[model samples]
Structure formats: structure tokens, C-alpha cells
Target: AITQAEISVQELATHSGQIEASNKALDDIAKQINMFALNATIEASRTGNNGQGFSVIANEISKMSRSSHEMLGKVTSSLFRVKEKIDATTAVFATSHAEASRGVELGSGLTDIFEDLLEKANAANDSLGSINESIQSQFSSLANIQNSSEELATVAEKNAASANMVASVTEETAAAVEYVTRSAMELTRISESLSQSIPTAKMFDEWQPDDSNEKASQ
Candidate 1:
């Protein structure tokens, strides 16, 4: 648009000058023809035979100047049209430039919004990653607890068997103590005749007391 405006403005200025130059050329032609007319009049009076052709030539020059004037008028009218078109086009160019600038401003705003959204998206992604990591840690902890519980169950089974064995040993020890007590009671009943069970003191063969045994007895 700027280029168009520059071209149009240059064209209008250049064409206006052409109109002026055309008018100047026509005016100069008219002046030259007028001088020729005066010269022809004087020559016709002084040399009647030679002046007829000079008069005709002067008339042709006048006619050509009139034609030039008519052409100049046409050129001037066309220049006015060109100037009006250029002015209108220049206004259009100015309006278009304004609209384009507004578009640029809108584009800038959209770019800012896009940048903000990108940042928010990145933040959300980071938060999600943190949450995912926390979930993973919790899962691992639960797995460890499950493993410990399995070991505890195994230990409990072993402890139950040990408790059963200890109960059996306790019953056997109680029975042995009861047997020992019964034997002690039986021994108390037969203890007074216990020495007669030994036969070592009896004289199996017609035993007579020797003189030394009698003395000892005394």
C-alpha cells in the first residue's frame, strides 16, 4: 500500500507538471503565431506578390496553437481525474495500514496467551509426576509390609509346635515325681526288719561260742 501510494503521488505530481508544461507550450505557440500575423500583414502591404503564402502560413500556425490548447485542456481534465483517484487510493492505503497494525496487536496478545498456557501445562505435568512418584513409594511400602507379615505367620506356626512339646514334658515330670513318693512310703513300712535280710551274722554250722568270743561278749 505504501508503494502504491508513493507511485500514485509521484504520478499525480508529475502529470500536473505535464499539464502546466503543455499549457506553456500552447501559450508560446500562440505568441509566435501572433508575431507571424503581424509580420505577414506588414510584408503583404510591402510585397503583395510574396506575402500571400506568408499569410496562409501564419493562419496555419494559429490553427495549430488552437489544437494544442484543446489537447492541453484534455490533458488537464485527465490530470484532475488522476489526482482524485490517487487521493482516494491514498486514503484506502492509510485505512489498510491501520487495520494491519490492529491485526499485529491481536497476534501479540494471542502469543502471550499461548505462552501462559504452555507454562501451565508444564506445571501440571510436573505436579502429576510428583503424585505418581508418591503412589509408587506407597506401593513399595505396602509390598514390604506384606513380606513381613508372611514371615511373622511362619514364626507363629513354629512357636505353636514348641508350646505343645513343652506341655508333654511337664506331664511326664509330674508322673515321675508321683512314683518316687509311693516308693518312699513303702520303704517306711518295712524299715525295722531291714537288718535281718542280711545272713552274715547267723552261724550256719552248730555254732559254739569260743572262749575268746565269750570273753568278748562279757
Candidate 2:
């Protein structure tokens, strides 16, 4: 819009120049008419009484020329004032255009800065989202590890109980073996005493204890 106003101001200045030139031409024509009127007054005076009408006509022509000259002077003065105003207006338009251009540049720069900031903000948001996902995944893995650890603890408890049962059974078997050994030694002593007290012991001498039972006792 400022550009359009500036163009219009320039066109107005051009038209003002043209109007001033035309006013100058009209002033020159008025001067020429005044000179012609003066020549006619001189000629009419030389012709004496016969030229009174010619003299009156020449005076009217002179009056009309003076009025035209005065009007032209006023028009020239007005044109000068209009030209000064046009020059001032043109300068104002030029300054406005410069300021407007600078404002546009500043606005564009601000827009670019805002866009950069927005892009960085979006990137930061994406990074935060990724970090959140990673944290969630790690939390899930930790829960799985905890479950596995609990299962391992349960299995260890069961194994310890089984070991204790085995140890108790082993102790019982050892006690039973000790009692059988004492019974076997008593039986051997009784048999030896019976043999010394009896004459038929010689016949029993051919009989022997079973080898399997002796091995088991040993």
C-alpha cells in the first residue's frame, strides 16, 4: 500500500510540473496581448478624432490583459505552494517505504527464530518420549528378574529340606547296624560255651555259619 501511495505521489508531481508550464505559457500570452494593446493606443492617437472607437477598444483590451496577468500571478503562486507540498509528501512517502521495508525484514527474522525454537522443542519432546519408553522396558525386566530370584529361593528351600530327610534316614540305618553287630557277638560266645560243655560238640564241629550272614555282619 505504501508503494502504491508513493507511485501516486510521483504522478502528482509530474502533473504539477505540467500545470506550472501551462501557467507560464498563459502569462506570456497575456504579456503579448498587453503589448498589442499599447501599439493600438499609439496608432489610434495618431489618427485623431476618427479613431476614438479604436482607442476605447484598445483600452478595454489593455484592461483585459492586466486582469489576465494578475490572475496568472495568483495561479503561479498557488502552483508554487502546491509543488512545495508535493515535494514534502514525496519525502514522507519515501521515509515510510524505508521504514516499512525494515519492519518486514525484522518480522521475517522473528518468524525464523520462532520456527527454530519450535523444532528444538519437538526434538526434545521426542527424546523425552524415547527415554520414558526405555525406563518402562527396564522396569519390566527388573520385575522378571525379581520373579526368577523368588523361584530360585523356593527351590533352595526344598533342596535343603530333602537333604535333612536324607541325613535322618542315614542316622537310623547306622543305629540299626550297631544293634545287629552286638547280637551277633553274643550268639558266637554262647555257641563256644555250649561246645565245651557237650561231648557231641565234635559232631557239630562239621556244621558252619552261613557265609552271607557273616559278610553282612562284617
CA lDDT of each prediction against the hidden true structure: 0.35, 0.40
1-218 per-residue lDDT for model 1 (tens digits) = 23432343344344334434443543443344334334333433443454344344334434433443343344334334433433443344334335444443334543343344334323433433443343334234323323332332333233453333323332332342243233223322222122121112121111221234334445
User: Which pairs clash (backbone N, Cα, C closer than 3 Å) in model 2?
Assistant: none
Model 2 misses residue 93 by how many Å? 1.1
Model 2 has an lDDT value of 0.40
Choose the strongest candidate by lDDT: 2
Candidate 1 global CA lDDT score: 0.35
Residue range 1-218, candidate 2, lDDT tens digits: 32333344456455446545644654554455445445544544554565455446445545544554454455445445544544554454444345444443334543343344334323433433443343334234323323332332333233453334323332332343343233223323322332232212222223222344335545
For candidate 1, report its TM-score.
0.32
Candidate 2: stretches off by over 4 Å = 1-3, 104-218
Q: Which residue runs does candidate 1 get wrong by more than 4 Å? A: 1-49, 103-218
Task: Estimate the TM-score for candidate 2.
Answer: 0.43
